[model samples]
Structure formats: structure tokens, C-alpha cells
Target: MKIQVSTELLDGCVLALLAEKDYYGYAITQRIQQTIPISESTLYPVLRRLHKESWLETYDESFKGRNRRYYRLTKAGTKQLGVIRNDWESYKHNIDWLLKGDNHG
Candidate 1:
């Protein structure tokens, strides 16, 4: 479904990924792309900023002789995700009602 999303949606999507599991950059990028409308070249910056803001933590994982940095939500990040999810759920409900009303009109 093509749901209307705000710019802040990316942050929420990233947090959602962390909620699901720790993800490397590539995995998170793919997951976000699948779930949300990511802006041009915005993924890395968002991840970096989230980490810089202490909302995320990173560690390296090694497999098949290669290592990549994976990200996980911090305690604060989980709290922020909860707040964002609540707000977005309300937004989604309100907008869904609006669109349905428009359809009937």
C-alpha cells in the first residue's frame, strides 16, 4: 500500500528495523526501502545522525571472512520508537478515516 509518509518516517522505519533485530547498513537500507519512502541519499546520514544523537549503537559482525557494522537501538532509541509509533499510529488512523470519508464524499 502506498501510504502517505512524513520525512520523520525514515527515523521511525529505522527504529522499527532495530526493534526487529540488529541490522547492518545494507540490511537496514534494504529494510527501510521496503517499508518506507527514503529520500535521495538520506539513509546513511540518518543512521549517522541517529548514532551521533545517542539514539543508536553500533557493533561489528563477522561472517564469511568479512565484517560489517551493525546497528541496534539504544535504551533511549527504544523509548523514542515507542513514542514515534504511538504518534504514527494515531496519524495513520486519522488519515485513513480522512481518505475513507473523502471516498464516500
Candidate 2:
């Protein structure tokens, strides 16, 4: 069964990818597709939100006679990534415990 992914998780994933290196929108979407099912329509809004939140910055670069907008994480974005990662870890641990029927509460 396919599980639904949350917007927070999607944002986290995007942030994580940007944490690795600057990438254009298409590249980011393609990388995300490798692990999760997401579309440009969904991703573009997230990118805009992140940019507005000052978590990401963008620049246009010429590549083969075309300008590509690349996104890079700011200091705030890095900090946010850490927060998201910690939350994900905690969430995963709880889910695993429940799924394994190891819940003591």
C-alpha cells in the first residue's frame, strides 16, 4: 500500500536535498521522484514558500543558452533542516515501536 506523505515531510525532503547542493527546480523534482511521488505543481509552491520564509535563496544561471534558477539553502534553512530531521527521527521511532507491537503505553 502506498502511504501518503505530509506537506511537512515534503518540505523536509526538499530542504534535505537542497542541503546537499544547489539544484534547479527540475533537478530537485527528479531527485524527489526517486524516493517519493511528487509533481512540479506541488513542488513549485513549496519552493516559493521556502523562499518567502527565507529558508532558501535562488539565483539564475545560464546553461546552454538557457537560464536555470537554482536554489540554495541559507543559514536558516540549514537550521530548519536540523529541526525537521530531529522531528522525523522521533516520529519514525514512535511509528516503528507501534508497528512492531512494542508499545508499552
Q: Clashes in model 1: which pairs?
A: none
Q: TM-score for model 1? A: 0.81
lDDT computed for candidate 2: 0.96
Cα deviation of 32 in candidate 1 (Å)? 1.9
Estimate, for each residue in 1-105, the C-alpha lDDT of model 1 and write its tens digit: 776665577788888889888999987877777756665377888899899978899999897999999999999999989988999999889888887886574
- Candidate 2 TM-score, C-alpha based: 0.96
Query: Best candidate, lDDT-wise?
Result: 2
Lowest-scoring 10 consecutive residues by lDDT in candidate 1? 31-40
The lDDT per prediction is 0.84, 0.96
Candidate 2 on 1-105: residue-level lDDT in tens? 689999899989999999999999999999999999889999999999999999999999999999999999999999999999999999999999999999777
lDDT of 2 at 39: 91
Stretches of model 1 off by over 4 angstroms after superposition: 1-4, 37-40, 102-105
